[model samples]
Target: MKNYFWNMLINIKNGQMAKKSVIIGPRKNICESFLKILWNEGFISGYKISPQNTRNLEIFLAYTKNGKPVINSLKFLSKPSQRIYYSSKQIWKIDSSKTFIIFSTNLGLKSITECKKNKIGGEPLIVIN
Candidate 1:
């Protein structure tokens, strides 16, 4: 099956490029968790379930004062065919200060920092810088 979270990422990217204030996507637990991560990391202003249609998600894009998108780059680590999973020990090898990696764990999606702090790891989903 296609990854809806990846499509949501693309929508956010496209929305930023097009200077769109908001991007709409299907409401999904995973996607909502990812959006929450983005918001916590300051990539997006925020997101909410659409009032008109509860099944839709409305994500507010964030931009800089000079009209530049907050999210400048994105890297997808896991694909449907080949998945990437990292243990807490292996996750400690990545030393990136400018980027954050999202990992899907049993408790839901967690960032690299959270994984490291909690001594847990999961599939490396995407890296945003």
Candidate 2:
């Protein structure tokens, strides 16, 4: 499924800038629904990351239909300080003018907090279940 998603993103990147933000969280029914929502909204260049693989931190950078940078998702290994560090790095890679909305479960709260503390600019819309 991961490979499939990667391929789909690659294809979507061939066109213009996609107005989308990266989503990271546990792999659940809601997460899939979120992807569908983005797709239907013309936010096709995106990526998903499961909690189990958060430590590795995979980043997916795609362009919008107009050639703007749209980072869909970034996966980072969960650790005491890694989230803040990775968030900074990810934020640096993209255009600061572009806004990013992150979706995650409660498990990501700590990381989200770290991002806020560092002023990474990623507005996290956490979903609690």
Candidate 3:
């Protein structure tokens, strides 16, 4: 099956600031880490964890002053069938600091910059720009 979290994120980005937030179904550690990274980087305004019969995560989307969604595109770099791993040195060599790169490093789900800072390597998760 396709990744539910990635699908949700892509759909939200395609909607172009149409909704303030979305409620996603219960997710594992990887998905949670991805959301946390997005919030910390300001790609998303905020998120709240709500648990009832099932765990649901509410995420507030970010938008520009022109009333446009902040995210232009969101793509997964790694998948269950095909994976991409990178080293800290390779990450530092990346020229574009503006593009957000999520890395599943030893320290947990971290951005490329964070991976570089910690001097670690990991599987590249996704890129959002």
Candidate 4:
């Protein structure tokens, strides 16, 4: 019984030591540009979704080769208004154990602010025109 309990405790501890992941939402061209920065800085190991394919808010989730959590993007439903609703819901789905990054341009400031107000883990990285 003692050995079994110790084994269980070890398993739990290992699970808790898992690295956190990240989520990223790139809603504008400038946001996409900053993504390159994140990638270069090694702050994010990998990323899902692409700016070129953001027509419907369907973004990607990136992970490290070692399976470490990295970054993710928001998905969109039909219609533009649905984007807010879907993005909010997606933000809520973000794992608390992971980090979230939101990339937005000047034009997307309002949207990023709203996301922040909603408790989405994102900050505006300004893009100079």
Candidate 5:
């Protein structure tokens, strides 16, 4: 999951969006949620479940008018062996305008803003800048 997200961000930043879409593999529920967040945040143009392969998902990366990638950076805050959990009270803004933090809660994967709005929290997953 770590390398997949990191590589996707880097590829998009390195002009892979020119291809219009990128295919990501072998299926994971969390990837779907992350892609949904990217879409909602306008970091991606669009995405869809792959019809050719149920295990694969297609992502449409976004670019600026001058053709620069929309995502600047992605950081994984919690490791499998060293997880970081946060309560709603512990959640704070991490560059609300340019960055977003994803968390895995009992309610499922949610962003910091969403968790704060809903008054719920969980393990912090990744931060994207």
Candidate 6:
């Protein structure tokens, strides 16, 4: 089985490092919702399913006015080797103006504020700064 999560993030990070305008990768599970969150939060420009290949996704990278990538870094909170979970209350403890944490809750992937708003605890998947 392919690990689309790792593949997706790595592509974005590498693309930003290279200052690419776009990058393509396999579609992640619940990709639409996840990508929508990132898009709405201004982390990414947007993403679309490939016309020739449905399993693939074409991601439009976002940049600053000076031509710098909006995404600074990505931190894995949970991995296949080691999973991590946090309570809704614990979500409040996370403090960062420029960054937000993505968690896999019962409602699928949600950000810190969403998790707290829904009063749900889940595995912290990635911390995108």
Highest TM-score: which candidate? 1
Candidate 1: clashing pairs of residues: none
RMSD of each: 1.3, 11.6, 2.6, 16.3, 3.2, 1.6
For each candidate in turn, the TM-score is 0.94, 0.26, 0.81, 0.26, 0.78, 0.91
Question: Whole-model Cα lDDT per candidate?
Answer: 0.88, 0.40, 0.74, 0.38, 0.72, 0.84
lDDT of 1 by residue, 9-65 (tens): 889888988999998988988888888888998999998889999999989999999
User: How does model 2 fare in lDDT?
Assistant: 0.40
| Candidate 6 whole-model C-alpha lDDT, 0 to 1 | 0.84
lDDT of 6 at 24: 87
Which sequence of candidate numbers ranks them by lDDT, best first? 1, 6, 3, 5, 2, 4
Model 4 per-residue lDDT tens digits across residues 1-129: 223322322332333234434333534444444444545545345455645665312223345677743432222222222322334556556443344333332334334334646554333322111
lDDT of 3 by residue, 8-107 (tens): 6665665554555554544556667777888888887776776553466666778889877778787788988898888878888876467888888878
Model 2: weakest 10-residue lDDT segment is 120-129
lDDT of 3: 0.74
Query: Deviation in angstroms for 73 in model 4?
Result: 21
Residue 121 lDDT (model 3): 91
lDDT of 5 by residue, 6-101 (tens): 555455555453545564543567677777888998878888778888777777787778876677666778877888888777785445555688
Colliding pairs, model 5: none
